[model samples]
Target chain A: MSKDKLTIGTLLFPDYDLLDVNGTLRMLGALENVNILMISQSGDKIKSNCQVGNYIDYNFDNCPELDVLFVPGGIGTRKEVNNPILLEFIKSQIPKVKYVLVVCTGGGLVAKTGLLDGKRATSNKIAWEWVTSQGSNVCWIKKARWVVDGKFYTSAGVSAGMDMALGFISDVYGREVADNIALRTEYDWHDNPDWDPFSDKILEKK
Target chain B: MSKDKLTIGTLLFPDYDLLDVNGTLRMLGALENVNILMISQSGDKIKSNCQVGNYIDYNFDNCPELDVLFVPGGIGTRKEVNNPILLEFIKSQIPKVKYVLVVCTGGGLVAKTGLLDGKRATSNKIAWEWVTSQGSNVCWIKKARWVVDGKFYTSAGVSAGMDMALGFISDVYGREVADNIALRTEYDWHDNPDWDPFSDKILEKK
Candidate 1:
């Protein structure tokens, strides 16, 4: 990769989970040459589902070309997944981007864009069935911490977004860099690649 | 309390943890009748610590008379705790407010104002000493999830703010109302009355 820099863009929408977006951004911000952008469908600031005065910045049209695109899940994803403009944009951008990351039901949005067709994916437990319903060709991985089929990476709910982002960093730079980022952020990165939230262990513990 | 309505104000600083503030707001928003305002030092949009674009709405001078003032912790709190203007504003407003809720090291700011003198308090593990060093005659309960010394309520890290907010709601309203809010938000309320984050159980688990 050129020292010119790489941009990571995360889609933000009304009622989106602010932490998922932030956790990812914080991790990526630690990368020396990465530029992170918070983009929304209308490019206008949208209220986060967090309701505590959190918003996402930038609009889709104004966002710079991205090397990575991340979509995080929240109540907003229900409407966002079906937003034609957003879906079309993702479809147009996916092939050009080096990686596409989706967390929680964000996978649903990517699924709706037909990008995950014939690929393995995962999402929040509440939205797993809905994710499956979106595409018959996509193999919905029932027990996966994150599914990486080709350039697409997907993780389970909220906190899982942090894991996937770190994983992406690990892939691009190396595991050592990702570990340092996780340590600095005080997050415990689960090294088990096959960990899944829907497992009987997690459900039973909950 | 008459249904005169209580206005709750939360401060936003650059690099503030969006989740800590938003989680508390989400709980408060579910309440029957309350006004919530997001205030910043300058009233300009304050980016969160994550730099993902979450911001609170109002500025300090424009803040309305508040029934309660909530301060949430993040990397931003490190600077805000000692900000002269912010400390002055908080000192001026503390006498008028009915209650003050400080989450994580947000208590450091309150402590700076001498409000927590001869009181007990707790904050996130990372800042417990910093909180104590600020001249509060504080009984630092290491294992406590939250410490409520009279009208002052202080909690541990990020998610613990949600718990302390619910506790505040219970005090202002009733246990039933708090319980209902917790259920609605899918948060489990432990009725321990005190929260200590540094206990062996929490540390041992990690």
Candidate 2:
């Protein structure tokens, strides 16, 4: 809860979506004093769905205390949801971090943790059925850009994470700080959490 | 220019902006048949400005034929503009690629090459003076989300590259394809190149 420096631990895995993590990091990185740690199960280079690889800074064991825990969605989450090691890592960090951000299908992974039970969350609309199936007890909102329940923030899809990240900045910093970051990055941030346009288009197709 | 499979080469360097590349890639990754190659000067892990590192797929010497050459912006551009190795690599790829996408201060690096001498372009508004100074002969537009001069595409700040990427997708694919990607990602695509809001805000401040 200290404001001096906030360390954010980002969970990464093989075939993870690139934008889910990096796009959100773009908004968070603009903050003055914040540290980013890329963490994987084995601390090796994690390859994205695009076949691009990123170096990991820490493993689950050596990860330092984090103010924020970021989990990004990708094809890897399908297999990782059943991974007790990764699931245990997410569960153990939830109680310790000040905030948890689940983007895209990452909502499914956290939903599997049984942490969002009786809580509201949202995930990628295209993968709605799979994500919602993971947590029957969790309240899944289909028409939401993002959902914030207590300390957890879950977004709709890949780029929606950027908007949710700005919302997080608005909460942690101030509205002005978030707006300034949007201006700096030239991002037209959908400041309103409920201002989602794609949910109906995608969900209705199903 | 092959319709079957397009190859994209992304240039990376130390202290490169994370979003400048990934945000754009988020839109491009949605394409059905495309290959992404991360290239750097040394074919080593290049550190981003946020201190995160990405593994490079190819070095300048080993780089292959590219359909699109992507250059990302960051604080490193100040120094990279003078890096002859990178400049030569960019210059070498320019004639071969169908399109060259430059994001944020990356315009400065490309401007140093003198290839955009008489072409219209734009860059991160906050770094306008520096970027414009890099190419005195280039016609730099002060207010634009992105500028397209023949085969080259230059965009404003970090997140603007996403809009440009969508624009690129629309140009190569159909407009419906670009809109579908936007809908899928839940991104508010600023379709018009002239719809820049930050240029006057940041540029006027200076």
Candidate 3:
């Protein structure tokens, strides 16, 4: 095993979409020595929007410095947008981490962090208007499957996080590692970042 | 309410890849009144090969007849292929369920049920040879993201299951419902059933 150890923290909250968390985890965790810390505010068993539960590895107070911060979203992101404690916890870590990857409406949370104020980002298209409105200054890409502005990677929605994770892995490790993951997972990844066709359908209707 | 209640039993064995279960659940659970049962051999919390834990909703002995049977896979699939109890449990349910969906190496387990004996199917490309060999009479598609043979839908691997779920939802609910899911999840779904580029790359190497 390579002596490269990168600590990855996947933040969890109430009723987050398990697809984003699990699919992204499947990709990132495939990397060697990539420690995944399931961080939550209370360190409780995080209940997913899909009715599944996940045991939190650390509470906000005990969360260590991470190499990468991963945030997933669901119905909770709508309510958690105004949560000062979660916002503060996230804000404190933004400057210290190597990067940040936001999934679905997790972009809403990241938007609250002010990290995307001047950065290009994206979020779950179904809740596009509400999430994009959170940060007025951020340039929200209306037609992106995922966005990578500097070290920040933001995915469109739940399953899109899987694509973002594959891209993220490719960025961190290289094409071979990421391709190996897609091959192992038997996923034909639409690696093109500008692959979101939902924006036209969902946003146009709304 | 549409009075549409479909019980989706997601089979969880020891060391199953959590992605297959999580991705498919995100899509199916989005529907109204769709119950997801995380079934296992013993109804114990399954420990995934990736070191994650998922609690089971039902054990094999107590599992009810289902509308849909969902199966995921991992290293455990290789061992479970010979498991008579597990095979019998699957064998018994073949006639009772409305349809069956097998993801990744879970196809290996399904092949042991002899239900796919004359059906076209696929599995994780990395272990395609071994999994396909389980059902000698079965027509194993060399390049398919997923295959539909009667009441059975078998996906090539991990993330391909998500694509299959989208297609399955489209087939059951209607184009609009599945479209809504893809839009809401912001997933740029591989809707084409024949999109399996990795099989050429991965299988060719072997």
Candidate 4:
């Protein structure tokens, strides 16, 4: 890859969890040849529920071709799932991107767009049912750090987005690169040997 | 406390974790009457690692008359600690604000301002030593959700800022109001009886 040349697109919508979007962006920015694009439903600044900062860059309609498309989840996904324009855009872009990454409730959006049907997927624990309800073809994985079924990758809850992004980096580059990225971000990234999404271990009493 | 009259200010700096700042802003936006302000050392569009968005307001040279001041932390704190201009501004405004809330590494900035001297404080676990080293007069509470020593309220890590803000609402208003706010925001505001700042159990172990 050329220096910071990987085109990474982050989806933005009203009421989306800014942390998930920003956290992933922070990690990706550390890469030498990464070009991060903030693509929103509209070509305008996206006002987050956090109201801290408004995203601006490319609109879904005007975004340049992307290498990776990352969809972040939040309460915003509840409405974005049904947005015809947004769904069409996502559906059209899936085939062109190298990787499709979804975080938390964002997995539901991917599932809703019919991209994750029959593919393994995961989302925020509270919204796993909603993700499943969107489509039965998706093999929903519960409490997974992140699930990779084919080229579609999904994660659980807010912070999990960072881990999933690192995982994607590992897949594209190498584990060493991902670990160095994690260290630079001050995140402790580990592969859980005992963790099982299908097992009752996560369900065991804390 | 009047409707649409609350002016909330958040300090932004280089390398600041956008999540900590945005998360707190999202919670505050859930309230009916609050105007958010993004203050930076420089009155320019502050770029973060996430590339999610740009700050709208700037309070670099002239501090806005604010109802509350929020400071978020990240690797940026290391640089902010030695910034004479920023430290002077924080010191000048410590006594004027209704509340001074410091999140994550931001607590270190507050500690450097000498406002937390002789008061209880907490910060990101990794930077606890740096915070302590900055000033020995402060009681660095190792295991606490947030240290509410007088008007200075400090929380641990990035996400803990949300809990600390909710607690601030509870203290300023009441538990019932805070609970209502939590319900509206869809956040499960649990009183973590075991919330120990120094305890390794605070975060999910890798």
Which candidate ranks first by lDDT, i.e. highest?
A: 2
Q: What is candidate 4's CA lDDT for residue B74?
A: 78
Residues A95-177, candidate 4: write the lDDT tens digits: 99988888878887788877788787877665657767876788887657778877787877665676777887787777888
TM-score of chain B of 4: 0.89
* Whole-structure CA lDDT of model 2: 0.90
Candidate 3, residue B199: the lDDT equals 85
**Candidate 1 local lDDT, B1-206, one digit each (tens):** 23667788887788777556766676777776887778878887767655554555678777778998888888887788768998888888888988888887787888888878888888776555677787557666677677888778888766577678888888778888887665433243555646342444344455
DockQ of 2: 0.76
The order of the candidates by lDDT, greatest first, is 2, 3, 1, 4
Candidate 4 TM-score, C-alpha based = 0.76
Q: Candidate 3: DockQ?
A: 0.62
- lDDT score at residue A28, model 2, on the 0-100 scale: 87
* Candidate 4 wrong stretches, greater than 4 Å: A1-5, A26-33, A125-130, A142-145, A166-206, B1-6, B26-35, B60-64, B82-84, B128-130, B142-145, B159-206
Location of the lowest summed lDDT over 10 successive residues in candidate 1 chain A: A197-206
- For residue B20, what is the lDDT in candidate 4? 72
Clashes of 1: 8
Worst 10 residues of 4 chain B by lDDT: B197-206
Q: What does DockQ give for each predicted structure? A: 0.25, 0.76, 0.62, 0.30
Residue-level lDDT tens digits of model 1 in A1-206: 23557788887778876556665666777778877777877766567664553454567777778998888887787887778998888888899998898887788888887778889887776556676677777888777777788999988766567677888888888889997765443344665647763444333445
Better of 2 and 4 by lDDT: 2
Q: Could you tell me every candidate's TM-score relative to the true structure?
A: 0.79, 0.96, 0.91, 0.76
Would you list the C-alpha lDDT of every candidate in the order shown?
A: 0.73, 0.90, 0.85, 0.72
* Higher-lDDT candidate of 1 and 4: 1
TM-score of chain A of each: 0.91, 0.97, 0.96, 0.89
